[model samples]
Target: MPRRVFVHIGAPKTGSTYVQNVLFDNAERLEKAGILIPATFAAHDQAMTDLREVPWRDPEAYWTWDLLAEKAAAFRGDVILTSEGFGAASAEQAKRAVESLQPAEVHVVVAARDLWRTFPSMWQQSIRARGTWRFEDFLAAVEKGEFEGFWEHYTANRMFLRWGDLVPPAQRHLVTVPPPGVSHDLLWQRFAGVFGIPDGLCEMTEPTANPSLGAPEIELLRRVNAALGDRYPHRMPYQRVVQQHLVKAVLQKRANNVRFGVGLDRADWVMALAEEQINQLRAYDCHIVGDLDELRPAVMTDSHSPGELADRQLLDAAVETIVGMIGHADELRQMIPPGHSGVLARVRRGIRRRLG
Candidate 1:
């Protein structure tokens, strides 16, 4: 039988970090189980960096696919490659991706969630990626679907759709990650199944939390961006240091009171949109594994006391900022080429040191 090749192209905000960490950590074990997660260098971190730097433009843009084929060709075990950013590929990119990987029985696994939850998480992700837009304004754009341009560029959903347009429906698998009620293990099991991993070969041992922004926290972020917009574009590394490290860290430390609740009106709008999306997806005969109803929004309830909500919100934001910093640490570290001038190295080192 031909070796199977699985591509877990993430539609982000779906516990992708945790999944990537697991695969990276257990590469040997999976290889023993006839599964291969390829890395050009012995360093696991290098694989991630390569994925990040893979070009998506021009004649040489199919380099990632070439890299994939080269990696897969060398591995005897089933091959698996993953990157959430792959979900944002343009149509031309998608076509090239498919053509480059031809002859491999490519199975694309996309983890999806209800838009109601995904929307807010995506907004937080945008903020982390240096996006400067108010939650209300973002929602307004989403409602108008004027966001199709931005969505086409940044969202995994659009990429998934485009990929589906290029590939046979049976070749794609849509894994719906149920909301908080379901066991996280169960969700992982479904994912593993799609990748053809045998039962018990993988275990969920990591407690990676990719928390989303509560309404109050998002509102605070909006205000911070608005206040700092002229002084610092959100994308600037300096602003990232201040906002994510200093400001967010202080707030996260004092979880006294910072609760956020969506008003009934917004909740309703979110639910309606989610339902519409779910209906549309069903038309594609996509393989949905969980209950779509789990996506329904609930009335806002305060988990923390009113007195504590403010502090807690600040604390959450701070933690989120710290997490963001950690996520970027490796990339920053690799950017400094070895044997550079001492002064240049010092400057790079100082910037990286500040990240912690």
Candidate 2:
């Protein structure tokens, strides 16, 4: 039976991808040390989706948590399962998660970020997930209970409310994301500590970071999303077409000087939320890997917001993005295999076959 389990429930954009990448990069080394990180657990993270009972494109997501728990029950070593999805698991979902990982000592780790920082990234993330809300409106909605589900991910207090009963105070960990411009190595070190990974076991080497958009680019995409509502209604097509193709190929290549931020007026509220979270978490006395003050957002003094973008700037960016998409189409017209079943197409076919 597994002796230990560490579940890294992420509040997104806190360098979770980089952590997962490092795990895969040194899987063998980690396994030899009596720590088992299954490739499925690290790469797909479908288990969280299963636990939360959320909809996703993966056919295998339905039973992924049970499958991993089964694997964990059979293993003799410690296991680490990570997913940002778990950060938003409801109380019932969290109970189910605890029950499934039976007999093993389960620990919860939430690498949470400041709302000021995480909210913007999450707005862009919502757009990437085919949401059509403007940044301002998204902020307003999330501030209220209207989109509390999204808000729950970044709030450790709410997360703890759901999962705190499942584990002892010592087993619950709050790994605060270091402030902007701090070395990510520090973040990795914190994660390694919570995972019981020893320092210098593997060459930290270079890091893999997911490319993210600036405020203007994200605003442009938001406008584009509103204009093209429901054309790619499902997750996979929207992901392949907008998220993968247009955003990665076109927008990410452009030089974006605008930074996303909360206004100076809003900074006080952001800090208050941080204070509330820190106070709530302190009562739990959870093992903290980094300073809780780091969760207090540093208000930007010279931010260039998406709303401040000029009409000409947006027009030029849109034109350039269209040109890039055209070039990608040309490349596909030249290079794609005749019977190429793209991933979404294959999934659609599979779903139809299942229905048939």
Candidate 3:
């Protein structure tokens, strides 16, 4: 049986992807040191999706949770399972997970960042996930408890409280993301510490960052999603074509000089709430790896509202979108196998392009 199980429950926008990439990159080295990161994170992702009862494209998600737990319980060395979806786990789901991985000393690690910083990134991510809400409207929904995902996954205090109920305080860990403008290497160091990974063992050579959009870029995406409406209602198609190809592989590579931020005037209540939450977390019995103050959001001197994007900014964003879509389309064209399937696929794409 595994001696220890480290669960990295992600509070998103907190450098989770970077950490996962490092782990995936160094899987062989970590395995040689008696630590096993499963060959695939797909099972873990499906498991979380099933646990949350969220709508996804995978039918196999319903049972992957149990399968992954079984794999972890049966392993002989230390194991690390990571997924941001675990942050949304209910008390019941947490309990079920704990019971399934019996005999292994389970520890939960929650990676977090300032709510102010995370909120904008979270809203932007939602847009990528096919959400059609404007930035201001998204903030309103968050304030009204309409966005339970924000509270459940992004709030540090709430996450520790829920997971603490399943595991002892000694087994609960917190890793605060370093302040912006600092090296991201520091964040990776703190995360690796939770698994007893020695320094210099994991090298970060790949550019695996999932970059966020500037105000104008996200604003344009919101408008596009609103226009598309139910035309592309399915998640898988939208994820592959829009989110991965257009957003990740194309749009993020564009040179945009604008930054997105929250105004102090609009963030007064949020700041107060964050301070109060951090105070409570300090009192809670858990292991903290980085400075707690880092969790306090830095106030912005100027905030850019997506509603006020300049005409030039809008034109640049539009032109970039067109260029990115054309590039992504060609890239996809090259991916199809050269045969009957390729010919039919090209014909369908040609008809769509001509019709548009």
lDDT by residue (tens digit), candidate 3, 183-269: 878888899888899898988755465667877788888888888868767666788667876678777887756877666666786
lDDT of each: 0.61, 0.78, 0.80
Give the candidate order by descending TM-score: 3, 2, 1
> What TM-score does candidate 3 reach?
0.89
- Models 1 onward score TM values of 0.71, 0.88, 0.89
Order of models, best lDDT first: 3, 2, 1
User: Clashes in model 2: which pairs?
Assistant: none
Model 3 ranges with Cα > 4 A deviation: 60-63, 144-146, 310-312, 331-342, 345-356
TM-score of 2: 0.88
Give the range where candidate 3 is weakest over 10 consecutive residues by summed lDDT: 55-64
Provide the RMSD of all predictions against the true structure, rounded to 1 decimal.
7.5, 4.0, 3.4
Which candidate ranks first by lDDT, i.e. highest? 3
lDDT of 1 by residue, 92-151 (tens): 766666665557676677777666556667776676555667665677787787788556
